[model samples]
Target: MRIGLLTDGGYPYATGESRLWCDRLVRGLPQHEFDLFALSRSADQEQRGWVRLPDRIGRVRTAPLWAPHEEDTRHPGRTRRPQGRIATGLGRAYGRRDRRRFTAHVTALVESVCAGPEAGPGPGEPDRAADLFTAGLYGLAELAQERGGLHTALRSEATVRIVESACRAPGTGRTVHSATVPDYLAFAAGLERALRPLSLDWYDDDALGAVDLCHAASGGAAALPGLLAKRFFGVPLLVTEHGVPLRAHYLAVPETPLSAPVRALLANFHGLLASEVYRQAALVTPGNTHVRRWQERFGADRDKLRTVYPGMEAERFAAVGEGEDGGGPGTLVWIGRIEPAKDLIALLHAFAEVRRDEPGARLRIFGAPVQGGEGETYLARCRALVAQLFPEEGTDAQAAGDHPVTFEEIGGAEVPDLAQAYAAGGVVVLSSVVEGFPISLVEAMFCGRATVSTDVGAVVEVVGGTGLVVPPRNPRALADACLALLRDPERRARLGAAARARALELFTVEQNLAAFRGIYLDLVGQAPARWTAPPDARHPAGRPRPFATPPEAHVLGDLIREPAVPGAARVPSWAVGAEGVCAGARGAGDGDA
Candidate 1:
């Protein structure tokens, strides 16, 4: 079975979140063929080039959400609709048929969003907002297929009018009802962007229509194509969200100026889209419980949710984990990208307290910030804060290496790469006030080092009480925890050993791959298989079944029919001590309904 793997702002691109995970997943599963459809977030991401793809990837298609829409070449002599030609010929223009359909669909969508899920009897469908949204979305998609594209149709004065009518519709929310003509225009523009996937030419039988399953890397615009594939081709969709895109939308500062009412309407629209995606998805995999809770609150079925922890390679730290030295006796190390959310300022203050108490203790900061210009500003501020917190040092106070707080990247003289960074510290400390998965904490665990991390995001869940936990932004508590580990070599050794054991047990690439492999097989098995196009003709197979028989009807041709005589067949792979492998309908860590 082939998979239509969909991703937004990541995968294939050299720079972005989850590229490594997507690369690993595709490479790990060789039995299934993958068709990658990636949406680049920026021109920079596109220019950076793609990661080298493997043989298992059957095809690759990409588009830029950041770029202007390319001209549609599907129809001959069909140029961009001329301006002021609205009354030319409802036939030559968006057919009177498709236009009416478009108006009905757009009306239903905006009304549902404005009136909210509590709105009664929406567009002759169920009271559920998801149903109403899906109905409207697919209706518009069908119209786009008949017409050239929705580039002009969605952004036209007609759409603006529909939005205004919906905003002022009966039972609408006060905020939506109070929208102005300009507000309607702003909202319509956003809808066009969000609904851009409908105008793409990738929904035919040669494209997503042929896939067995649509596996979305994340939700939001990334999953839009997958939703359409499921709607038009009956493909089962499996959506995996490392970070809930809906939450990201709500948290992100708007790039363009917009009114509060416009923001609220846009948020509601996205929420409705997310709910619809979840409603149609066969499974929803959340990276952590935090994201899973968000999905559940957004109406994702609890039974469909699977908690798949992001996998990391442990081989890089294996040698250091088993090395002779158990790291420095009086050092605490912090690793990961440097950003404001990391709260390096708090770590510097905490390290100052540890320096006063331990006297000889040192804090080595390792790893660069996330790619972009924000890192330089944040890094400079952190450096200044470090200087303010810790003054005089050995011999040369001007030299950064001589200071108690040494900031360095992954590659340095004493600490080269993540393994050496972990090896340079007896205890690993994470001071982030905001984090997604606390991957740095997991990396420390893999290196067989005791960790002291702030209680943020997935730290507590991933730590599972194997390491010391402290409150975020609390310098004294962080200092106390680091001091306890720094002073007691025996306790540090014990916790480090246990931490490494737990990491090996639950968070290895092998376990992660096994779980997903099972999920792929299960999803493929559940997806309905497609037969040949027409009953009268063959699908042009190398060895066609019979001229009379349909593709679905097949005899036992070369498949071995005889059962094993005694101990003839080898044990199935899943039955051979693969205790962590996901099996049957219930995968590993699938939440009970």
Candidate 2:
């Protein structure tokens, strides 16, 4: 079966958020033909070059998330070489009727975003923004295809005026009311970029339309193309969000550069978009309960959501995890990307508290600052705070030589890799006030070390009663948990063993691949949806492929639409028996792709 693996700033790129797991999934299922659809977030990501893809990856198509617009007419199945960003160019002409249709669609989209839980005006009345948004988005796409592309028109004064009208409409939020003219223009510009996928040549029968399933690596920008694919074609979409996109939007942008009004407006837009994505998706998989709860709260059906844990290669740490003893008795280790969210300050204070009772105890920080990320400043602050911490408690700075704390990076001579670093300490500590699955904690578990982590973002879920979890930002509780494990070597040993057992069972790469493989087969077993046409297609000659949906309503049954649904011959042969092949047990029978 053909799979369109969608990604944003990940996979194929040397440095990306979801690169590892994506590669693992593709490599694990070698029998399936894969098509890579990636969106590059930065020029550096494009310049750094792509990771070597296996032969099974039949095609890789990518575009810049930050570029003005592509001038090249290259089809998406082939690679588009990196080029300079050109300013926004032109748009197709819209007649009087076209203008009215566009206005209603944009207005509904904006108003739905600004509305409350029962999103539209009345109960069961329906916001219909999803329909309007898709219609408007594709309508423009059809126009772009007929009359060259929509670069200049998307940035026109008319587009800004429509957005502003929506913001000033009745029932609009206070935040929308506060947005100035400049804010509206800025947002309109950003919206054009976000909608770039609509103008792409990817939606044809030979590209995204040909794929059996569209599997998005992350939500939001990455999933946008998948959403379009499902819209243009009857393909089923599977969204796997490791970190909830809506929450990330709330956390990523501050109110300084963007006003509260603009931030709120953008958040609402993304929220509405997320709701639509969830509603249309055949299956939504969240990496953990933390993300799953976010999805459910944002209109995802509970049944449609599955918790697929992010998998790691456990065998790398197998040697250390299986051993009898786990490092020094009085050592505490913290390892991961150095960032403010990790809450190193609270950990340092907690370590000070631990030192009050056990002076000989040492803390070893094994990790480096996230390169080119928001960590260099935080890293320096942490190092300074570490030096000042022990001295303020009347402890001799001289006696505490080099501060009783050591901050080091991995891949050094002493610690060649992550496994060796985990092996150098008995107790692994996670003091993060904000986290997502805590990958380092899992690595610690794989290395058979007791963990004391703050209760935040799936920590407790991952621990599963195997490790001590304390409330986030509580230094006393964090210190005490570490103290309890440190004082009792037997308890630490027992917990470490249990943690390793849990990790081995639930968090291995093999298990993750198996779960997704199962989900892919299940999605392929449903009926194809019936097609739907817009209210007006004045110029039918230039119209793109007719969009389709089930005549009644889109239910779970509409997912598979091949041999099982009357049109047996129309079904591609590859989609017929994916269950027995990809779902089968792995062996050394085949070599690496």
State TM-scores per candidate.
0.84, 0.84
Off by over 4 Å in 2: 69-101, 114-123, 128-135, 141-148, 324-327, 372-374, 392-403, 529-593
What's the lDDT for residue 243 in model 2? 88
**Model 1: pairs clashing at backbone N, Cα or C within 3 Å:** none
lDDT of 1 by residue, 440-471 (tens): 88888998888999998888888886899999
Tell me, what's the RMSD of every candidate? 8.6, 7.7
Compose the digit string of candidate 2's lDDT tens values, residues 350-440.
9999999998888889878876547898888987787688655343543443447888777877788888889888799999988877899
- Give lDDT per model, in order: 0.76, 0.74
Error of 2 at 212 (Å): 1.1
**For this target, which candidate reaches the highest lDDT against the unseen true structure?**
1
lDDT value, residue 473 of candidate 1: 90
Cα miss at 565, model 2 (Å)?
A: 24
